[model samples]
Target: MTGGTGLFISFEGIDGSGKSTQARLLAEHLRSTGREVVLTREPGGSPGAEEIRALVLQGDPERWSAETELLLFTAARRDHLERTIRPALARGATVICDRFADSTRMYQGLSRGDLRGAVDTLHALMIGVEPDLTLLIDMDPEAALARAKARATAEERFEDFGLPLQQKMRAGFLALAAEFSGRFRIVDGNRAPEAVAQDVRAALQAQA
Candidate 1:
């Protein structure tokens, strides 16, 4: 959590790994437990961030260089943190974010070549915070790609890169979980939605 009173949880995984669905389920579960929950997503959580999101997601994947994209993402995230996530946390609400900095780390590092250091530096200097808990939905890249393709939209900039990239992204995410074990929980996403949801709930409960 960015604030003292709330619990900030973020979902991370390759596109189509069901992280978004699980994020929503967790929010619903938390709300049912009488907690005030705010569900949001990266690159587009706050109004200003949403505008930045279109620039990043709508254009051709090569429209911006890796470095330029990173800056845009950071700017949007700063706005998201200040305008939406932080405020919700300060009000003692549980913030369930669909994606966050972790995606940038993996996506840019994988697609843009060895930019993890830059990503880390930018995040530490500009954002300076992280989710208290991150739920990583692990799944086979093949299946995940299928899922991603089924729901294809104009925001296919990243998805257009194809399956091999997705596999690498999954490996990157797993490595990240190991690196930040204290704040990450890897849940198997190959199972039924209910089963995955139960696992997520159990992970959060165990953390609690």
Candidate 2:
């Protein structure tokens, strides 16, 4: 599937929404067709961003205040854009990012409602880039939360927020999709992985 120029695609959802899997599947599909694809994720993509990821994801849920956490996420994203995403796109590659600025908007905003404004302002001032296409993997929060719990990783910091927050995040994502309809595509994530992959493929193919 080709989109005229360098395509920047980001997959976003609450933890366990199966976005990561879809991102991988799409990357593989593109590579099989002879396209140069760069698959990446946030709050870790570049080496410096990955370091920042460890600090944010491995600590106690309350280790950093909401404001502090937002800063860290922003810093990581800046590093990721400068060191990883921008270069790949410059080389005319398709960059498939598992998560992007939207996560910070939803998570930070959902956790501390007042910080939503800060999130937006910081994004405009610091990050300043948006994906050409964003696939929002929509799903039932309870099911997704269960999937997140099953993983039991050290990065449980975000997953540890549990069901209620996941619900809020789902809403937050939908809201963002509405706000940025030009670049967002809401994809159902309740189906089998292959089915979901096909739907994602179809969505991009239509755009192409």
Residue 40, candidate 2: Cα error in Å is 0.3
lDDT of 2 at 32: 100
What's the lDDT for residue 66 in model 2? 84
Reference-based lDDT, each prediction: 0.91, 0.90
| TM-score leader | 1
Model 1 lDDT on a 0 to 1 scale: 0.91
Enumerate residue pairs that collide in model 2. none
Expressed as tens digits, the lDDT of each residue in 87-163 for candidate 1 is: 88888898999999999998885556788899999999999889999999999999999898899688878888889
- How many pairs of residues in model 1 come into backbone collision? 0
Instruction: Summarize candidate 2's per-residue lDDT along 98-128 as a digit string, tens digits.
Output: 9998899888866545688899999999888
**Model 1: how far residue 127 lies from native, Å:** 0.4
Error of 2 at 163 (Å): 0.7
